[model samples]
Target chain A: DAGVTQSPTHLIKTRGQQVTLRCSPKSGHDTVSWYQQALGQGPQFIFQYYEEEERQRGNFPDRFSGHQFPNYSSELNVNALLLGDSALYLCASSLVAVSGNTIYFGEGSWLTVV
Target chain B: AQSVAQPEDQVNVAEGNPLTVKCTYSVSGNPYLFWYVQYPNRGLQFLLKYITGDNLVKGSYGFEAEFNKSQTSFHLKKPSALVSDSALYFCAVRESLEDFQKLVFGTGTRLLVSP
Candidate 1:
């Protein structure tokens, strides 16, 4: 079975531009979450999508948004990118019913804001 | 607010020796602890989690963690380390309350196992 997969593994965007990263959750998974990992820092939650609705969001700005499709795939969009937006964007997936709700992550999309 | 702390920025060990990475957490209610590993340029890989029932949680690749409720600690351990085990280890925690909460991760500890 295929695990979590992400697209545009590496990307470069200019300041004030927008970028969209895609992710396909692991097989049999339902929920999708987005995280941002800055250099030398741990990942910070951006938001989580369940049932095609954004269930929870973190302390991110309104520039960050996400969408979960009916097929359990997700897309993270960041608008008006700034220099600080350069980081590794990770996409994780999990089953809502699982006891601890263990999440599986994709390799992540690297974004460089120039 | 839930949070986790990994005190050590880096740890060095020899192959075939035992290893331990410390972690501490704070949460309002019960804490759901987790340990994950990451290679040079990869996503975080789930190693184990402590939701309930057992304090000693065993996970993939001969890894294990002991959860201490009072200490609010969940330290990752392994009996015999391998050179391939040299990677970054992260500790995360989430509140176990009825409300939904995202996992809070630490800065991560770099484990270097030498041959």
Candidate 2:
């Protein structure tokens, strides 16, 4: 009955460095998606993972990548981080058949790039 | 390109008063609309959605949304606003034809309920 869960509640990284944030989807969920919420802004879609492969992506560049495991957990990796990359990274889970219309989100990991 | 628009940057209302947050969207095909609320330092929580039912959709936390197909609008409403209802709200839209199933979100609206 646990909801979506994310790790490293807070992280700090510098320019050109890489960071990985983890998320465990809610029970009975099969798809995972990542989003970035900058200050004073709404959450922007990053990418989605289904069947252990990235099925959908947003306007993000190659610096952002993600992975979905057999257990339905997900990880979001950002490389060559820039100061603008500082934001709240959110992980949302849903069923593949659900059409990604309705999603459940985790508390999110706050990433700070300096 | 699908997109959502939340015209209000912030809204203020007294406790127990009715409140509304406006949203509009643009998409190619049948539009799947959603409303989500986000508290400080928390993830977005699903509030309500409009798929293909009555224009009026009710959801958790006493929230409801009315979808207007002709207007391409989905507005969230609450009969009696509570102080705890103060939060950031987002409207999203997804196109039925899109393969990625991505949701395009609006800029967000901040609601403040004062007692």
Best by lDDT: 1
For TM-score, the strongest prediction is 1
Worst 10 residues of 1 chain B by lDDT: B94-103
Pull out the clashing pairs in model 1. none
List residue ranges in candidate 1 displaced over 4 A.
Answer: B97-101
Cα deviation at B11, candidate 2, in Å, is 0.8
Every model: iRMSD: 1.8, 2.0
For model 1, what is the alpha-carbon lDDT of residue A88? 96
lDDT of 1 at A21: 97
Q: Model 1 over residues B1-115: C-alpha lDDT tens digits?
A: 9889999999999999999999999998889888999999899999999999889999999999999999999999999999999999999987862323378899999999999
- lDDT of each residue in A24-84, candidate 1, tens digit only: 9999998899999998999999998989999989999999999999998999999999999
* Model 2: lDDT of residue B106: 97
